[model samples]
Target chain A: MFNAIQHYRLVQRNRNRAGLGSWHFEWIYKFFLHTGTSRRKYLVEVRQYDEHLYTVDFYAKVHNVNRYRLRTHQHAAGKLGATVLAIIARTIQQDPQACFGFIAAAMLTETTDENTRRFQLYTRMLELKINPARYKVEAFAENSTIFVLPHGLVSQPDALQNTITRYDQIFREVF
Target chain B: MTKYSAKSSKKADPRQQAREERKARNRAIAPERIAKVHIMADGRKLLELKPVQIPGYTYAF
Candidate 1:
């Protein structure tokens, strides 16, 4: 918890150093409740500590594949899954009263591997089959908004800020 | 019953066969190496110079 606070501070510092004035940062704390049921729905309690710090209920593991590479849902091939769809589903099921919602992901990469190619095929297939928007199926490049701070830069405010600024540019392009 | 040889097969087209073979080969070729570049908050560029070889899938189920 203390480490998360320090990391949040570094992120704020990084954001300020980059002069990304339009972008806003907030720190929040979230607690998860386990409702004993078959449904995966859980209660998330969000507490806003300050303007730039916050906590999340969960963190998805960083994809090992390159940042520039797009991934699709290929279970055995290790491609990107239908993750955004799942997130939307969970959000709908989550307790309605929660204040802040957060999602974190690692940086994108350039190289494409066998898994990535497989995932791409799946994405294209889905695009043809149905309205992907209904399921929140967007391209990985377009979907990247959060760049989970790399460990080395967690303390380096300037570096983290610059990286995030770059991501902001990327998100802007897709948007 | 042997189902393999019992079914009647249609004549295959030479052009279609060639196209399928080419498509398979293209799919097998690895994509070009593209580095993951990052700009530090200080405006310095950081490239992932060393690619760590992960042994297995990062998740289960």
Candidate 2:
């Protein structure tokens, strides 16, 4: 049931070195999804925290006739989920030992109930797409922050827990 | 012989209790704060950088 959604082709945009601000991101990628008459543009940002830890953040905007507007839902959620999974897969491929953390942003949601639904949707997507054997998925339900840790660190439970604690602390302090 | 109290007589549904607890926790976190990190076309220039405050997470231009 989960495999039905097909992801769009992701294109990496060249970074402008001069305009690069203080927040140095490892890379950025974008993809276009054509649904019906409107085209949705999704931008993904990857920020490396340490040698093997990175965070992925992405948002989507609908390309209206003249201007771009942020649209969270386009009736193509499954496709978007698949595309995000593809992005995570690509990132892990680049660095096999890389750990990832991301927050399920509740952008433009009408109410708190809708926000919770969005968070649950992201949690379900990760459960379906990520392999438990290869990576450990830990979700902080209160804030919708999720961490995908490498399975290799499972042997040392203290290290794994400490890593998650440290990363969560850093995420809160910075963002 | 005494009658049972209305509050103590009825048992709470565990699932319902759990659901309410989850909702309360979710309510504590504001939606806007959840996605505070905005990524713009210029790559996060919109954010006010306080690299000195956060140790070991400094950004390099």
Candidate 3:
């Protein structure tokens, strides 16, 4: 069932090089989603906050003549969601103890309602794809932020809660 | 019962009512302020970064 969701290949770039200086991301992954007619470019950045905590940020763009522009086309929403899920799965596999926090910001839309819609879309995707046994998912719908913590940490409730609190505070400050 | 009285007796669908309430609740929650960094120079710099080439690589999901 998971493989049924079509996604483009994610290409890793600059493993050792520094990421965006201002953001301090450790790694950047790039992928192009082919929508039958045109291909959209996407960049996924992973920023490590602590030993096992990280945040993922991604955006899509289209090459317009010479420069790239933000792609606002909504037709590829399914593929976009699938690609992000694949990235998260890959990240967790690489580091079993890794906890991820991210925001479903309405980058393309202007209205607050669109932000809510985007948050709902991301929450739904996470619910459908992420396994409940291995990970504990907590979402702040009002803030459009989500944290996925490893279920192994449930044995240490204090540590888990602290991590969530720290990440929430960081998200509020950084984003 | 009279036609007007019978029409007035009809109740709203519980599922539909719940959905409307959910929508209102969602709308009431203010969205977080998202930084417009993508349109800025930092975002473009990411696009400028050169992509590494891999031999015999094929696109897969």
Candidate 4:
């Protein structure tokens, strides 16, 4: 659990280092649904947009899933109008609902064995029944910057670029 | 004629069953612990630190 916390902190540090200083960050510890005694700490980043409010909430998780807790989180997402960023320490579950925001946002995974490899979710692409080729690049986001053709995604530079660009655009348009 | 019924034939209603399940769930969930911290360039301080418990609200630990 502490490892997960440290991972979340490191992600926040990286985000700060990436020159995204405008987003204000806060740490929130939400109790896990299955074992109420254990709490998962997540970073909530808030940015102001034209007298409106935009917020992003993300969690760095090691493993396991709790349906009730996620449903409760959905309430928070809808209530706060925040985007959910689900970062896993390993592979993603085949069940889309296992990870929060699987429908709209991409999921990122980190594999312990790979040193330089990063992976971004091709979920959206796969949902469209289109196959995206694997493109390898040293991207800044999740697991392997190289596109792994798991299910969905078109490895065309534009499509892959758009997928990568959405990371930033979300923060921009959410406002 | 008077109808005869057994006293043990009474079954728990769905409402009562739901209440029991809710109680069980409440018992299983733990409350959350929280700490408010204030940070400065030189150092950091914890302004408030404790478990959060609200009256008449679900508490998950």
Candidate 2 Cα misplacement greater than 4 A, ranges: A1-25, A62-70, A107-115, B1-61
Residue A74 alpha-carbon offset, candidate 2, angstroms:
0.8
| Model 4 alpha-carbon miss at residue A166, Å | 2.8
Number of the predicted model whose TM-score against the real structure is largest: 3
lDDT of each residue in B1-61, candidate 3, tens digit only: 7999999889998999999999877654323322111121222210011112344432221
Pick out the ten consecutive residues of candidate 2 chain A with the lowest summed lDDT.
A61-70
lDDT of each: 0.31, 0.58, 0.58, 0.28
Per-residue lDDT tens digits of candidate 4, residues B22-51? 975653212232122323233422121132
For model 2, name the residue pairs that clash: none
The residue-by-residue lDDT of candidate 2 on B15-43, one tens digit each, is 99999999778654334333223332323
What is the per-residue lDDT of model 3 for residues A8-43, given as tens digits with 9 covering 90 to 100? 455544443554332333566777767668776777
TM-score, candidate number 2: 0.60
TM-score of every model?
0.23, 0.60, 0.61, 0.21
Across A41-159, the per-residue lDDT of candidate 1 in tens digits comes to: 12222222222222233222235343223232222121112332233223334432211222223324524232344343433333332222222122222222222222445345565
User: What 10-residue stretch in candidate 4 chain B is worst by lDDT?
Assistant: B44-53
Q: What tens-digit string does per-residue lDDT give for candidate 4 at A129-158?
A: 111122111222222122222223322445
Where does candidate 1 chain B have its weakest 10-residue lDDT segment?
A: B52-61
DockQ score, prediction 1: 0.05
Interface RMSD of 1: 14.4
